[model samples]
Structures are given as C-alpha cells and as structure tokens.
Target: MEGYSEKQLGILLVAERLFADKGFHGTSVRDIAQEADVNIAMISYYFGSKDKLLEAVFRYRMTATKAFIQDLVDNDTMGPLEKIYSLIDRYVNKMLNEQNFQCIMNREQMNREQSPVKDLIWELKREMMGLMEPIVTRAQEEGTFYKDVDVVLLMSSLFGTIHQVVPAKSYIRSSPEFADMPDDEFVEYLKVRVSAHLKKMFKAILTHEF
Candidate 1:
C-alpha cells in the first residue's frame, strides 16, 4: 500500500474482497478486473498473474502486521506481560476490523493445494514467531511467567480463539444474549470480550498459578 499507486491499491483492495468471498480458484482475473473497475491488462501490469495478485493481497495485509509486531518487540517501555497484553489487543482489533483478510488467510491455510501464497503465509508466521519469542523469554527470565510455557501453543490458542470467534458472528448473534446488538456494537463487544478473555487466559498460562 505504501509504494503502490492509487489504482494499484484499489485493485488490491477489490481483489482481496473478491478472493475472500470467492475461493481463489473460483475467482478469475476477469472477475477481479470487473470488480476493481480496471482492465485485465492493468492487473497483469501491476501484479503479473492471479497467483501473484493473491500473493500481493497477503503481503498487503501482513506487511503492517509484521511492522507492528516488530515495533512491539523492540519497545522497551512496556513490561513483558504488558507487551503480551498489547499484542493480544492488537491482534483482536486487527482480525475484527480486517475480517475479510483474515477470512482469506484462514481459507488459504486450509486449502490443500500447494502454492507460493501458502508458503508466504508460513514464512510470515515464522518471522512473527521469531519476533514474539523474545517477549516470552524475557518474561520467563524475570520469573513473571512460567518456564514451561509453550510459545507455539500459546500463540495458537490466542490466534485460534480469535479465528473461531470472528467467523462465528452469525451463530453468536442467534443467541438471545447477543441477538439484539447492532453490527458495530457487536464488533466492539467482541473486541473487549476476546481481548479480556485472552489476557486472562495468558496470565493464567504464564503465571505460576497454573
């Protein structure tokens, strides 16, 4: 988004929504072009092919995420536990706000077809994990968190919970409890609910109480 022109960014945004609504194989170049209101040649000129466009979509969403995590990791003012809480909040807000991109990510990961997009996702996960490890290590070293904490599972639990909840809004709203909330209200409610739940869950998992 930073480097791309207005037209290019517009196409990426359009393609991202289309890819999320329609599966990658189900969405064609013409579909993206039509939705983006550009000629197919523009897509070809900007991204080269459908596969590369898909890759660009992933990169577009993940680039900011990578930078944010890196900044959180490098930040010295926040304590380790505080950083973890902040991380949880950032992810919850991001997933809630960018539900379409998250949907694309979840769908592509489940897809069995091997592609560069899949590889890129894994690569990004690894890099983020690498950035996050130091926070865990810092906490454990300071006796603020337990030594036995599994970073992978900890992240999996955090992300898995968010992933489960974001896509289940319809099911959740069917219940009398959340049935009447407006869409904006529901999302804000989810952000608070999920963030608090995750922070508490992590505190228990990382602290000696467990």
Candidate 2:
C-alpha cells in the first residue's frame, strides 16, 4: 500500500476482489479496468502487466504482515511462548478480517497454473518458518517447551485448523443457529473459538504431552 498512489491502490483493490472471485487467469485486465473505472493504459503504466499486478497485490498484503511478525519476534519484552501466541492471534485476525486476500491465496494454491504469486507465498512461508524456529528452539533449550518438537508440523497444525473454516462458511451459515447471525458476528465467533482452540493445542504441543 505504501508505494502505490491513490489510483494505483484503487486498481489493486479492485483486482484483489476480482482475483478472489475469479481465478487469476479468469480475470482479465479489461475487467479490472472497467471495475476500477480506469483505462487499460493506466494499469499497464502502473503495474506493467497482469502478472506483475498480482505480484503487487501479494506485496501489498504480505509485506506489512511479515514486518509486524518480525518486530514481534525481535521484541525482547515478550518471551518465546508469548511471541508464538501473538503470532497465532495475529494470523487468525488476518484470515478473518482480510477474507478477500485469504480467498485469493487459497484459490492460488488450489490452481495448478504457474502463478508468480505462488513464489511470493512460498518465500513468505519459508521466512515465517525460519522466524519461528529460533523461538521454538529457544523455548526448548530453556526447558519451557519439550525437546524434539517439530516446528513446521506445529505451524501447519495452527494454519490448517484456521484455514479449514474459510471455505465452510456457506454450510456453517446455512445452519439454523447461525442463520440469523450477521457475518461480522459469525467472524467474531470464529476469532474467539479459533483462538482458544489453537492456544489449547499449542499448550499441549509445547508441554509435549500430545
């Protein structure tokens, strides 16, 4: 969002929504131009190409998140477990609040096409794993966490558990109990329920009783 101007941001936002709704290959540059009420030349001038624009979307969404997590991990005030919980909480909030981006990401992963955004996704994931490994290792060394824990497996457990809910909202909302609930309220429910569940799982994993 920082490097983009108002016009560029507007176009990128439209592209993100469209990309989420329709797969990247399905959404055309003309569609983005019409949706953003801009000419094709403007998009080309700003982002160079459709693939580049998608990359920009990834950069726009992920750069700040990576920086935030890095800061949280680097902070000396919070311990390893505190940082882990903070990371989990932040991730849940991101998935709920930024559903469009989440959808775009999920769709990209599901798509078998060679997308440039996939590289960014994998890079960020690797970076995240690298960032979390030290924290887990430190906790284990300090005897606060069990030795021989699989950091990647632990991360996947949290990621998989939270992500599985995004695609099931339709059936979940179709249920009688959730029928009357507003989307926002349901997402709030998700935040609370998921946060508690992950915390419990993380506690079990760290304590090595699982």
Candidate 3:
C-alpha cells in the first residue's frame, strides 16, 4: 500500500479479484487490464508480468497484516493473552473483509507445483510465525499459556477454522437459524460468532481453562 500509486493499487485489486474468481493461471494480463480499465502495457509497466502481479497482490494484502501483528508484538500495554485475542479478532475481520484474497491464497496453497506465488506465501507464513513466537514464549514464561502448546498446530487450528467457515456462507445460510438473515446481517453475525468462538477456544487452549 505504501509504495504503490493509486493506479497501481487499482490494478492490484482488480488482479486480486480476477485471480480469485478465475485461478491465477486462468486470469491473464488482458483480463486484468480490461477489468481495471487500464491498458495491458500499463500492467506490464507496473508489474512486469502476470506472475509478478500475483506476487504484488499477495504482498499488498499481507503488508497490512504483518504491520498489525508487529504492532501487537511491540505493544507493552496488552498482555500476551490479550494480544492473542486481538489477533483472533483481527483475523476474523481480515478473512471476512478480504474473502477474495483469502480464496486466492487458499487455492494457490493447494497447488503442489512450485511457483513464485507459493514460495512467497510460505515465506510470509514463516515470517508471520516468527513474529508470533516471542508472544507465545512470553506467555509460557509468564505461566499463563500452556508450556506444551504447539505454536504451528495452534495457528493451524485458528486459521484453519476461519478458512473453513468464511468460505462456507451458502452452507451456513442454509441452516434454519440463519436462513432468514440478510447478507449484510449475516456478515456481522458471522464476525461476532467466529470471533467469540475463537476467543473462547484460544482462552482454553492458552490458559488451560474454559
């Protein structure tokens, strides 16, 4: 978001959506250009290639998330547990708001073939895990979180739940309780429900208490 101009930002957003709706390989520079109402040459000039554009999209989304997590890490006011709760809330909000980008990430991760996008995603994941390590360690040292907690698996559980739930809107809507809810209401309802559920689950996991 910082280095990109308004036009570049617009192109990145359009590419994000197209890549999500149509797989990365399926979405071409021309498609992005037409959708963003820019010339193909402009995209070429900005991103160099479709692959680079894909990388830019991932970076554009991840940059903010990384900054937010770093801020939590640096903040002294919030205890580690409180930071974790804040993380849960932030992730829920992120997944809900950036569903399209999440979809692209989920799709790309499933591909076994090696590519720049996959490499970038893995790099980002490791960086994110590194950012969280100290918080988890601090909680353990403080005798608040469980000493035996597995950070990777714990994160997998947290992220996996949101990933599974956020994309299942149609299935969730089919349930009787939410059958009558409007789209706008359902999104807010989901954000509250998911955030509360994750907080409760993590509290138990981290503190060894319900």
Candidate 4:
C-alpha cells in the first residue's frame, strides 16, 4: 500500500474485478490494461508480469483483513466471546461486501495449482488462524467453550456457512420474498441475518449447554 501510486492502486483495483470475474487464467494483461485504461507497458512497469499482478491483488486484500483481525485480537478490553463475535461480524461483512474477491479465493482453493499466489494465500490463512487460536483456546481453558472443540473445524464452519450464500445471491434476489428488496437493504438483511445465525451456531458449538 505504501509503495503503490494512485495509478498503480487504480490498476490493482481494476485487476481485482477482472481477475475475479474472469479467473486468473482467463484474464489477460491486455484485459487488465483495457479495463484500467492504462497501457500494457504501464502494467508491466508496475507489476512486471500478470502473475505478479495477481499476487499483488491477493496480497492487497489478505493483508488488510489480517491487519484488522490482528487489531481485534490485541484489544485488551474485549473478552474471548466478544473478540470472537467481533471476528464474526468482520468476516461476514467482508464476504458480503467483497464478493468478487471471495469468488476468486474460492476458485483458487477449489482448483489448486502451482502458483506463488496460492502460497501467499496459505501464509495469510495461517497468520489469521494464529491470531484466532489464542482467543479460541482461552475460551476452552476458561470453560466457556467445550474442551474437545476442534478449532480448525470450527473456523471452517464459519467460512463454509457464509460462502454457501455467495453463489446464491441471484437466485435469492429472484425469489418472491426478496424480489422487491433494494440491493442495499438486501445486503443489510444478510449482514444482520447471517451474523445472528453464525453467532448462535458458534455459541452452541463453543458451549457445553445443549
């Protein structure tokens, strides 16, 4: 973020949309150039190659989320449950707001290949988990969460539940119940609805009470 100029940032934002829509392999440098209204030379000058640009896109998005989560973890006033709920709020908002980037991430994970970007994705994931692990462990140690709870599976449940709705936006929109809802209202509906559901589920998963 520091090193990038406005033009470079503009290019990356445009590339993010294109790469998300057209898959990294399906999108060409020319496509990015055309969409960003910059010349091919400018793209090469900024990122050197398509692969590098893709990596840059992944880094841009992942780093921001990682930093935000790290901040929540560092807040001393928040208890484990509060921190966990904050994480759920942040995660749900990101998935809904950044649907395109989420799509690209899901694609990359589903179709694994030899790429440096994938490695970066894993690194960011591990970093996020490291931040989350302590909060989760503290909950268990304090008897708020079940002693036998599996952190990884629990985290997966959070992601899995939210992502299932990403691909269903169109179908959901077309349904009679939501057909008249405005896009902004619909998104807020999801944020409130999904966050509440996950919070309830997480509470059930973490607590001993049935």
Candidate 5:
C-alpha cells in the first residue's frame, strides 16, 4: 500500500472520482490536489498538467481492458465462444458496478473533440474492434457463427447493445413489472436479456461470418 508514492496513486484516485462525478472541465488541478492531500505543484511536477493527468487516467483504464483481452486471446483453455463470453462478462460487470464511470466514459467519448484524452479514447475503441475481429473470424471458420455478416457492423452492434443497457436500466427498474424485483434479481434479469442478444447475434453471424 505504501510502495508507490502517495502522489501517484493520489492522482489516479482523485482524477477518476472527479472525472466521474464532474466532467473534465468542471474538475481542476487544485481540486485534485486538495482531495489527494498533495501539493498542486506536485501534480504538475508528476503529470505535467491536469490534462496530462486525465490522459493518464484513460491510459490506466485501458491497461485493465488490455490485460483481459490479451488473456482471452492467448489462453488455450477456453474455446472461442467461451473467451467471448468471458470478455462480455468483464465488460458488463464493470458497467453494472460503475454507473458513474460508465457515464463519464460515454460523456468523454461524445465530447472527444474537446477531451484531453481523445486519442486514448479512439485507440481504446479501435483496439476493441481489433480484439473482436479475430474471435469472430475464428468463430466463423469453426461453424460457430455466420459467414456473410459484416465484421465492422457486427462490432458496432455489440458496442451498441452494451451501451444501451445503462440508459434503459432506470426505465426498466421503475416499471411496474420489474419494480418488485430485488436489485440482484434485476441485474440477473438483464444478464439473461443481454446473453440472449449475444446468442441471437452469434446465430445471425453464423449464418453470414461477421
């Protein structure tokens, strides 16, 4: 816990929380310095500026994504479909657990034109599509999905499916039919719903090879 300098960890902790609670422009170096109990000058000394700190945060987020994707790509224990499921599970779990972080990510993406982390955002997206491509290719050859589907289109649909979940969660939870369910039950219900979509998409792609 004490290994890395407090200032470094401080930068990450403060940046993510602020970036999630308030948009980038709404957060400032002074705020982060105060929250992290470090000098404002230290932040600049370590990260150059608030903008650089924000970019560092996006880079940190990508590290987690990269690790899981790399493991799935390299692991021989699980087949292609299982690897895909594992990937989806991690992605969905993060969203379900961190609604604020999810919201922040989407906001940053929408405002990428002004974001300090725009390059990292684009790279994260392109890397995600690249990760899916090989799995989809392998699945098609293995008769797991369709051969005629467009890879990019299919990837877009996957992103769309996951992204839509957050916006609809409030609506679904407040509805009379779903309101009675417990929180865990509600998430499980969603898991099944998304899994069904994944299966349906998998089947569709099987018929065509997206």
Candidate 6:
C-alpha cells in the first residue's frame, strides 16, 4: 500500500499535470493514479474523489499567487513601473520553472463550471484585484496615470495582458521572434510594452480628456 501522506502529494502532482494538459473533464482518476504510481483506492482514501483532488490543485496555485502578490505589494519602495516589472517577473519566473501552475489556472477557468469551486475562484480573483486596484488608484490619483482614468478599466487592462501570457506561452516560445527570448528578457519586454501602452494612454487622456 502507498503511504497515505505520500499518496496525497502523488495524486495532486499527477492530477495537476493531467488537468493542465487535458483539463478537468479530460483527466480521469485512473490516469492520475497510474501517473502517481499509486492505486485508485489510495487516491480516494486521500482526496475522497477526483473533483476534490482537482480543487486542491487549483487552491494550491491561488495560494501561491496570493503569496507572490502580497510579497510584492509589501515593498512600497518599488516604483510603479518597477512594481509592474516585479509582477511580470514573478509570473514569468513561476511559469518558466513550474509551467503547471499557470496551466491549472487557465484550464480551470475554461471549465466555466457553476460548482462550489466557483466561490473559491472568485475569492481568489478578488484578492488579486484588491492587491492591484489600490496601486492603480494611487497612481492615477497622484497624477502618474492620467486623471479621469477608470480604475476598473486600467486594472482589467493590466491583468488581462498578464493573464494571457501564461496560456499562450508555448505559442510565444515557439515563434521565431520570441523563441530566443529568455525569461528575464521576456519580463523586461513585457514591462516595456505595458509601461509604454499605459504611458501613451495617459498622454492621450491628458491631451483629450480635459
């Protein structure tokens, strides 16, 4: 018999991999059990069911995200652009090392389920948004961003761009132009791109909004 504690981690590891590659509906308990080198009975004994195990994988990613964003926000010395770089850096670095982390999030969202995990997912999103909102609001209020900018819209723009990076990384990495870009180089490019866009938007608003 598999050790109970080891089986739990094993199931999660396999489940996350399968979930990332094939999604929740695509992966099965048997696939996970086989990958983990454990018996299906052990999976049930540890997680009770496949759904529970899947949820745990999602929770793990969100927990890591919370810690990352919190750690960055704790550093007030980081300039707005630096903060953006930090955010992108952490995200890219995480993806480069543990691509499964990002895959799990994107896959879960694709499910579009109305299950109990819905609330947990929403709560996790709220934490990220809350972490981001204050920074944007402060920047706008302090005239770093253009006045009259919509905080919600800005927040969406920032996160939407960053969020797309994960699911599309393979495509980007395969592209000739991006194929040669290392993780740090890619993060810097993102920083430049995001900063340039926001700056242009701010200037446009300054010349047009008022």
lDDT of 3 at 177: 91
Q: TM-scores of the models, in the given order? A: 0.95, 0.93, 0.96, 0.93, 0.81, 0.68
Better of 3 and 4 by lDDT: 3
Q: Indicate which candidate wins on lDDT.
A: 3
TM-score of 6: 0.68
Q: TM-score: which candidate is best?
A: 3
How far in Å is the alpha carbon of 69 misplaced in model 5? 1.3
lDDT of model 4 at residue 81?
76
Q: Between candidates 1 and 4, which one is better according to lDDT? A: 1
Residue-wise C-alpha lDDT for candidate 4, range 1-210, written one tens digit per residue: 777899999999898898788889889999999999999999999899999998888888778788888887778888877888899999999999988789888888877666657877788888889988988887778877788888899899999998997787777778799988999999999888889998888888888543
Give the per-residue lDDT of model 6 (tens digit) for 39-146: 889888878887788677767666777777776667778865466556655554555556675666655666666543556677877888788666556766677755
All-Cα superposition RMSD per candidate: 1.4, 1.7, 1.2, 1.7, 3.3, 5.5
What does candidate 2's lDDT look like per residue over 1-210, in tens digits? 677799999999999999989979999999999999999999999999999999999889888888887797678899877888888899999888888998898888877888888888889889878877878888888999999788889999988987897777677778899888998899898788889889888988898545
lDDT of each: 0.90, 0.87, 0.91, 0.86, 0.76, 0.67
Instruction: Score candidate 3 by lDDT.
Output: 0.91
Comparison by TM-score, 1 against 5, better one: 1
Q: Is candidate 2 or candidate 5 better by TM-score?
A: 2
Tens digits of per-residue lDDT for model 5, 54-90? 8777766667777678778778788777776677677
Against the hidden true structure, what lDDT does model 6 obtain? Answer: 0.67
**In order, how many clashes per candidate?**
0, 0, 0, 0, 11, 0
Off by over 4 Å in 5: 1-7, 177-189, 207-210
TM accuracy, model 2: 0.93
Provide the global lDDT of candidate 4 against the true structure. Answer: 0.86
Taking all chains together, the TM-score of candidate 3 against the true structure is 0.96
**How displaced is residue 82 in candidate 1, in Å?**
0.7
